[model samples]
Target: MTKEIFDDIFGKGNSNWQKVSFLRRCFFNDNGITVNWRANTPLIKLWKQAKDLDEFKVLLKKDKDAQKLQFTHEWLKTADKDYDQYLASIIKETATMQYDVWSDAGSVKVGNAQFSFLISHNNGDGHAIAAVFKNEKDFISSPMKFITSVEGTFNIYDYDCGQNVIVTLNGRYDVYVYCGITCFVKK
Candidate 1:
């Protein structure tokens, strides 16, 4: 499709027209027949509002979302139906079917300070663990460190003074604070 035709349907300078044009080329081959087809007003509006290809695909999948757009050509309608089915299959294949549940052990107190812990699975080889201090006072203990019992696995820690401390650990680890307080872990 030419830029002139795209501009006519979706107004000038639309960022998504190139992507839409590419997808149209993949789905529809009848350029001559498409030339005679009028712009579906509701569809044009929806296309203009779509921020990206992903959002446009989502809009196309929802019947209620594109209910106002009337398909004027048989081939255009067929292409849209095929694209929707393709999206559904791809979504099903890539969907996250299971999630890891981490048990919480509340906060641990170390001397005058208390810390709340959170652990997130990285979906790969490691987990990101964060320890947030409950109070606004910095841990005055110099050279604060996170000690884990797992041999050969080291902790990469980032401390934001009195705010929070983050550590990335590989595999299963039992982490403890420098003050001998055990942090929460996945149960």
Candidate 2:
């Protein structure tokens, strides 16, 4: 009877029966039979292999270059909605930037100010910078440029400098200021 239900749900032989395991034992009583079975499908197998959500996230990040697998309609019917939503959000955030050439690393918002971080690669080297914006047409501070390196490692930190917001970029090379530069603001 359990096999019949499994076959009906998984379309008979679609899943590996040898790998399928039971989560609970079948009990018989006047109330009839109760069996708890877990199907070790590729999706379920991946979920079980992860120790926790953070580990799952790391796995997803590492798998970004590989082909993505999604839940089937049948699985979605019984899958955890919270887990599904969490996966969707992770995919959305990670999909926002590409790593090869240029990317928007991320942004931080402090009160009414916003700091945007960007990374650009050129001639086999990469540089990262932070741009501060006050409203849409003004600049609170000059763009802060970090060190350049072949690895393109960069990070941004925000702090309050007197009454103004200061964004600092940490990278591989020595820091220098490029002031009095012609800047263009795109609407």
Candidate 3:
């Protein structure tokens, strides 16, 4: 299911594993239609006054046109060129969407300590949470309760690591973290 959607959004061109992993992460949500990514720094504000997604989209389009837009997709196009821009772009773009399920692919340096994750549940119906953090040391936190779904579609989770940490998913699902700056693969 996810593999097909991945092919659709990003065609079968060059097969870069990191690129493939990152793009696959974008469509991990339940509906498998949206991509949500969080910027390293905050970007343009979605008109808070707007009541719904439709209204938000309208305001977003307006805000973008007014040149009120900030560094939205620049990270995708030119994220620290010294590193893997291809992998970086897809991760950044995926983090900006609103969805029930989504994940990201990334890597950390040898001395790096932790990786942050943004998790969210858009649906109102209560669903028991199930998340796993896998690496040299693995941990799983499951059945976390979300009594009520709120306005903000995401929350932060950090995995403290000894060596290096890699990618993060936006849910309590099992994922992989690895060493090096470009070595996150979801299993």
Candidate with the greatest lDDT versus the true structure = 1
Report the error of model 1 at residue 99, Å: 29
Pairs of colliding residues, candidate 2: none
The total of clashing pairs for model 3 equals 13
- Prediction 3 global C-alpha lDDT: 0.28
Q: Residue 30 CA error for candidate 3 (Å)?
A: 28
lDDT of 2 by residue, 61-112 (tens): 3453211332221233234344434433333343322111122322221232
By TM-score rank, best first, the candidates go 1, 2, 3
lDDT of 3 by residue, 111-187 (tens): 11233333333222232122222231222111112222212122322222222233234322232221111112123
Candidate 3 local Cα displacement, residue 104, angstroms: 21
- TM-scores for every predicted model: 0.21, 0.20, 0.17
Instruction: Name the candidate, 1 or 2, with the larger TM-score value.
Output: 1
**Residue pairs in clash, model 1:** none
Provide the lowest-lDDT 10-residue window in model 1. Answer: 134-143
Q: Give model 1's TM-score versus the native structure.
A: 0.21
**In candidate 1, which residue ranges exceed 4 Å CA deviation?**
1-38, 65-187
Global lDDT for candidate 2? 0.29
Each candidate's root-mean-square deviation in Å? 18.6, 18.1, 18.0
Find the number of clashing residue pairs for candidate 1.
0
Candidate scoring better on lDDT of 1 and 3: 1
